[model samples]
Target: MEFDASHSSSSLGARVVLIPLEGKVIRYAFKLEFQNTNNTAEYEALLLGLVEVKKLHIKMLKVKGDAELIVKQVRGLFAIKNERLRHYRNHVWDKIEAFNSFSIEAVLREFNSKADSLVVYAALLVPHPDFTTNTYRVELVYRLSIPDNFESWQVLENDK
Candidate 1:
């Protein structure tokens, strides 16, 4: 799995691209509805990627991302100072526990272009009524808009 995050003035977006050992590529894009820092968005992207891997019942997995902070934190080389990050870190650990073997590495952005493009695409997406679909294997974009105080955001799914 590869992950990336994009941030704008008013919103954040995350994307995860999964390439199974069988060589099938699947992409997931998300627009975060809440206010979050760049690090938070990175963590969110990592967590979302883990969730996707877990759903596949994969016993062993390797994750890659361009976020050095998140990679270091997950490897225990950096400390999580922010309270929100601590929560996200815990969630990441929990999801990772589901896998029998898991490892995450930080790679340069140039090497992670697929995930990077997914994030950029998510950030630029505008919701429209004409988009509606529920196909799992195709490229999926989730446009989520929520209030700053909202506890949960609804995912609007579209196929691309």
Candidate 2:
């Protein structure tokens, strides 16, 4: 599926992207935070996208965004300078490399406004969950319990 997101940066306007990841669409959500710059937020979106997509166990992905600086940085065309962004950038790189293959492309603002709006809306949403890792809507509603001592050996012996 191709997921597009755009984040409003208040002082700097908004940033957005489209990401394609193969999966069951079991989960979907976004997070907004205080950051040093808009570029960082854009990269953070991609990083978060990859991390969450990985949790879905998908093998391929394509990331699209309107932030040219972020796409360039991720593609190695630009050097990351901010100390905080450096860590976030590295984290995103690690997530991207974990996949068998991934790509990032720069999109025009005209094409990414909706996603950019999502970013801003997410940032301002109230009554939001507090967890750092995103979750599926189904996962959030279901409750599962497992016994403390249900070992495989026990199951094998029970078969007899």
Candidate 3:
């Protein structure tokens, strides 16, 4: 699975490409209507991909993304100091533990170009008249995958 994300003053978006060990590749992109940082958007991308993988009953997964910070934090190479980031990391780890086997790596942006472009396209919200594929999909998400606060939204902060 490959994932990437983009964030702007107006929106947050993410894309995921699921490459089965043997089968067709699946591509997914989503535009987030809520407020979130680029790091959270990266986590959202992975979370969305993991949900789809779980639905397909896939036991083993190798995830690749261009978000170096997120990848290193997930691998325990970087310390998560912020409360919100710690929450996101813990949530990601919980999902990873459910798999029989899981690995995540950080790749160069060029290597993750497909997902990166998909995210940009989704964020732009321009219709692709040439799009005629059943394997690719874009969706609009009205909420965050992980809430700003575990207990309540009242505690939300400007983590960015």
RMSD vs true structure, all candidates: 8.4, 12.6, 4.5
Compose the digit string of candidate 2's lDDT tens values, residues 1-160: 2234434544222222234333322324355434335555565456556656777687777766777877788788888786455556666776777778788788886776545544444555422243233423211101111122336634853797
Candidate 1: clashing residue pairs, number = 0
- lDDT per residue for candidate 3 within 1-160, as digits (tens), equals 9999889997778889898778888888888887788888888888888888888888999999999999999999999887778788877897888899999999999999778778887777654343446868888888777775576642553341
Among residues 3 or more apart in sequence or in different chains, the pairs in candidate 1 whose N, CA or C atoms overlap within 3 Å are: none
lDDT over C-alpha atoms for residue 125 of model 3: 65
**lDDT for position 137 in model 1:** 23
Q: Model 1 compared with the native: what TM-score?
A: 0.77
82-149: candidate 1 lDDT, tens digit per residue: 75666677668767887788899999999999888768656666432222343112233342222222
Ranking by TM-score: 3, 1, 2
Q: Could you say which candidate leads in TM-score?
A: 3
Deviation from native of the Cα of residue 125 in model 3, angstroms: 2.5
Which sections of candidate 2 miss by over 4 Å? 1-35, 126-160
Q: lDDT (0-100) at residue 10 of candidate 3?
A: 79
